[model samples]
Target chain A: MTDPDTDRHNAKMAKKKAARDKIMATKTDEKGLVIVHTGKGKGKSSSAFGMIFRCIAHDMPCAVVQFIKGGMGTGERDLIIKNFSDLCDFHTMGEGFTWETQDKSRDIEMAQAAWAKAKELIADPVNRMVLLDEINIAIRYDYVDVAEVVTFLRDHKPPMTHVVLTGRNAREELIELADLVTEMELVKHPFRSGVKAQAGVEF
Target chain B: MTDPDTDRHNAKMAKKKAARDKIMATKTDEKGLVIVHTGKGKGKSSSAFGMIFRCIAHDMPCAVVQFIKGGMGTGERDLIIKNFSDLCDFHTMGEGFTWETQDKSRDIEMAQAAWAKAKELIADPVNRMVLLDEINIAIRYDYVDVAEVVTFLRDHKPPMTHVVLTGRNAREELIELADLVTEMELVKHPFRSGVKAQAGVEF
Candidate 1:
């Protein structure tokens, strides 16, 4: 026989409980992550930023390492790191993106160190979200070893960590390992029509 | 007869001249301006992030205040803001998106304050970039005064400043004034297909 008081309590819990708690209780959190944002489109990094913004709002520990564009000349990194010093950890490999870098060896080295840093954070289940900006394109150029990256992510700690990889030209192997994957296929671009990259539009 | 050396120089200059440059050169610099992004597709904010990331690399001043998400807790803001603290500004409004806001008065109030902050920064030419993310949607809901925003932009300074607006439902006036505009129209979404919003893909 179903007790009336027990049924009433269950109803209350269903209506008032935190949605996150409900989700966490039902699904086993998968620590494994791989997000490949590829396309001839804009906003690949911005898509990753959306995740970063959301993750931090949730109180999840996170880190960001932009491979090709993490240099001293950028304004976004400066603006972000200065304001939220206590809650976030920001690191740039001090290397610009490949198209801007002429030396292939240096490019590869930057990508390698970036991968290592990402691996270090992933190992610490405390870092829940990791944004690897423009990584797939770097991998495509062999700027870093894709095999090593795949292996590291596959072995990442589960139930407490997540990783977000954003760039164009995502690999099939990486996509296969990703529990969640978003492919941003570009349909149009202003640069194609001869518009220069504005400071806030294309930076 | 014209000098051969002068003729050569004249030819070179003529070859490099652009049809629009003469007019553009005379226009005043855009000290700063706000960009609003909204749409059915993903990556509205990602585009803004690309600019932000690029700005951070350059050591330019920038501030990001994302509304429609907060208090859920995330580490994206926490981690990057740590190392690049001197360069960037990161603030999440923590009140999840407007669709979820359901409170019209609260939404309007949030829009007003956020717009106030963005306008303040944007008016400063030294700020470089001020992305008023999702401003289009806010305007659509009457959360902001669309006419007033257009008037401010119409009287903008150029070159020295730039405003990047990202979002769907860009009003007639906003698009007319935008030096650059991009629309991310949705073809498909994972959320509609029953896949939950992933940490990195859709935070």
Candidate 2:
């Protein structure tokens, strides 16, 4: 005798499979994406690095242009450069965070320099991916002109290069232009409970 | 004569450095964390794997127990097991997603088995980090007991073992127990725009 529960499960799964297949069938387009990772929580930069790692595993060349975060060395930055030096272009262009530099004009200069590097990377067809790490923060602070950045992103980016922008407080125009955007919301943070950031975990 | 911009920038940076130093001095405590990555967006599992990569780079041992995601092979799973076999303990225990399997009892059985493996990993002091990937979906679907999982995480986890749980619709109790919880909010997704999941980006 067949188990009633198993029978029911099989029927349900068959229906679900059909629905999923239908949806999957509708999805067929393929193109490079303008991706944004933003908001008040963690993992924006981490997720970008994850994609970089994925690209590295696939033997695709990638570049990272870090803005507004150059005071300390990060494990990801170090490991990628050390392991995949030929395939990765790692650039830390900012002197430090705004709160750590306090010079608005200097910050603007650094951001512009970083943007120049980002543009160069984006223009290179050889680079499959370019991560503009913390560029949103620089744009948010007016260190880089948002409108100009948006215009370049819309017009100048290579057709096959995926660009990932990560930071808190991403502007409205960028979000509207992005093919994908994820806003990480802080539900709870250990820092609020007095837990300090660890090297491997935070960096 | 000193360039006005350079001189101004130096003085401003010095003051900013002093303020940052003051804030940095107070952060001293260090402990393992119970981190939850949940909600309606991408990057939950990707971020967890990024942490795993960090741990691997630091020569720390890590383990992954995947629930509700075992039908297909992922690049991360394949690469980590192949390259860092000694450092990573990867177990994909679930048969597939709930909709794919559609068997409540079998799903529950798989979840319980996965939990058993997770407990064993957590109990072993050798594993510095344990990622319970997509366990939240199992718990949300009633395949596993959230209360029991919470109790083990709170009372039984090793002092220095960092645990990262990732999935959508994490229970309130689990969030409450987590040291850090990040909710990945979906601002936009390519699937909505009829774009299929790509190999490097999605898996």
Candidate 3:
């Protein structure tokens, strides 16, 4: 005779599998996504970069337009630009964080220039994925107009091109428009405990 | 004469640099970290893989032990095992998720086997990073003991070997002992919007 425990477990799994299968069956549509990563924590931009790497692994063309983070080079940036230069378009557009720059008008000018570049990338049909790094922070600081950005994202983005916006304080309107949004919440940080960011891990 | 805008920006950056330099000077100690990624959103395991990729790019050795994902082949698992076999010690230990397996004793046995492999990797001083993918889900289902795991992580892991645990429902003690913790909150998800998991994006 079959074991009673095994029989019970199999039955439960079968039921769950049926439910999952039904759900999976109903999802057949495919389209590019408007993805957003935000909140007061680390890894927002890193996660976006992870997606870009995934796209590159699949031989998809990708572009990154960094805003508000231009003071130094990072290991990820260096490696991607060095190795995957043909598959990836890497751009560092910001002068620095607002607190470092300390000039509102100049920040706005830089943000506008970055947005223009972002628009150009978005319009390119060959780009399968485009990452707007720290664009949320630019919108939060009023360096970029949220309304116009939302309008452009909704109306002008290529239909099959995935776009990722990453930074803290993502606008609510942007969140509403995004197909997927993940908020990276800070639970505990080594920085608060006097640990400095390292090269391979935090850069 | 320098442009006023450029001069003001330079002065502000210098002041910020001074503050940053002071903080950087105090952080001289470097040690391995226990990083936890948990919550209701996605990207926990993907972020860990990103770190592994980063380590591989830096020519650092890494290991991964997958506990509760075993039914199907994923792009990441296939690609890493095929391409970076030398640098990555990849292990998929669990038969599948608990619900899918539906065998408590079998699940516990598999978890124990996975832990054995993890211990071996942890003992190896050559590994610079170790990713315990879905170990939290195993512990959550009572397949593994949290206290024992924590004790081992605290006392046995190599000093410079970074360990990453990724899954939902991370235990409070684990969180307390971790150097960095990120909770990925679900703001929005395409799965909820009836989009099925895709190849490059999801896997």
Candidate 4:
């Protein structure tokens, strides 16, 4: 006993629902933006690694460009050198650490190479996530162009791709543009005790 | 200026130094092993990701097999989903954690598939590093064979390829043989305040 107008309206609603479902089915999302982990604290890169695990939980690919520490002697690095290449693209800068490298020019050169590789990843549409590990410290050291980095990320971000920047001394402009930013303050560290970093712990 | 016998001794010493230098130059150890990050702490895989950055500094490779988290709408996962298929080989158990999985049998099935991949890497002689990620927690859940894992690691560990296993409740036997062990105790957690995990911090 419904009126013709009511029946037609119900029919229109059904069509609209169908159209929404169709859009949902066919939609392809470009990835998200960037996450920056910084501050003079502990566990910045550690936080980024947690994201890697989360991404992998769903079988997403991830890439890492480590800028600060390039040592091959650490146990953790040893493990990655042996295994994660297949899971993710991993590139290390040549310098171990600024304090450890002892030569400032040498450290900057290594950082530049790492940045070159990292730049390629950030530009690629296929790379969903890129972690610029410890590049903040390099920026602080005047090793690379902070302005260039900020501009590149804003201009060249891929659809659906996300990047994470980690290190001490994240610049203010970079933090402002980041989708998320964290600062870790170190209350204590075993290093102050003159204890050498154990293989698996610090590295 | 020395006698003929003394000159010969000096020549031998110089030759020994040269040979040592040559060996160092020719060594294939540009990379090291991959870590299997596990544990119940707030940031086990986070630590691993930090190391991934370290590996990239050396232009090395790394693999991460994420277990016990997946199929949910997570900001981190969505951000990196684009990268999982190629540059990084990531497999999420899709079962979430033990409490969340609710079905014990399902967890075991998923964990077995994960271990299959881990076993392959563990047995491979050429993989620079292999990160099992959470096999230790799986073992605690009765998802994997502790004995089999121990045997495989002991007998099949490739020369120069190192493995890092992280997780809470790591069996004493596994600890005994580890070249390095780091115990991360939870001092405080957001969950205590009834805060759900943030996308970047806990993902």
Best by lDDT: 2
* Model 3 spans with C-alpha error above 4 angstroms: A1-6, A70-73, A101-106, B1-21, B70-73, B103-105
Q: Could you tell me which residue pairs clash in candidate 2? A: none
**Which pairs clash inside model 3?**
none
CAPRI rating of model 4: incorrect
TM-score of 1: 0.59
Model 3 chain A worst lDDT run, 10 consecutive residues = A70-79
lDDT of each: 0.60, 0.84, 0.82, 0.60
Q: Any runs in candidate 4 off by more than 4 Å, and if so which?
A: A1-31, A70-74, B1-45, B48-202
What's candidate 2's DockQ score? 0.53
- Pitting candidate 1 against candidate 4, the one with the higher DockQ is 1
For model 3, the docking class works out as acceptable
Interface RMSD of 2: 2.6
- Candidate 3 lDDT, A1-203, residue by residue in tens: 56887788778877887887788898876778999988886667766777777777778899999996752226567768877889899998998887677666788899999999999999998999999999988998777899999999899998888999988889999998999999999999887767776655676
The digit string of per-residue lDDT tens for model 4 on B1-203 reads: 45675456456645665765565455332223323332343445566555544444344454556665642224333433453333234456546665444455566788898888877765665544556666678787667888877787877778555565656677766765554444443433334333343433445
Off by over 4 Å in 1: A1-32, A46-61, A69-73, A76-117, A142-152, A155-159, A182-203, B1-38, B46-127, B142-151, B156-159, B166-176, B182-203
lDDT of 1: 0.60
Model 2, which residues run further than 4 Å from truth?
A: A70-73, B1-23, B70-73
C-alpha DockQ of every model: 0.16, 0.53, 0.47, 0.07
Worst 10 residues of 1 chain B by lDDT: B67-76
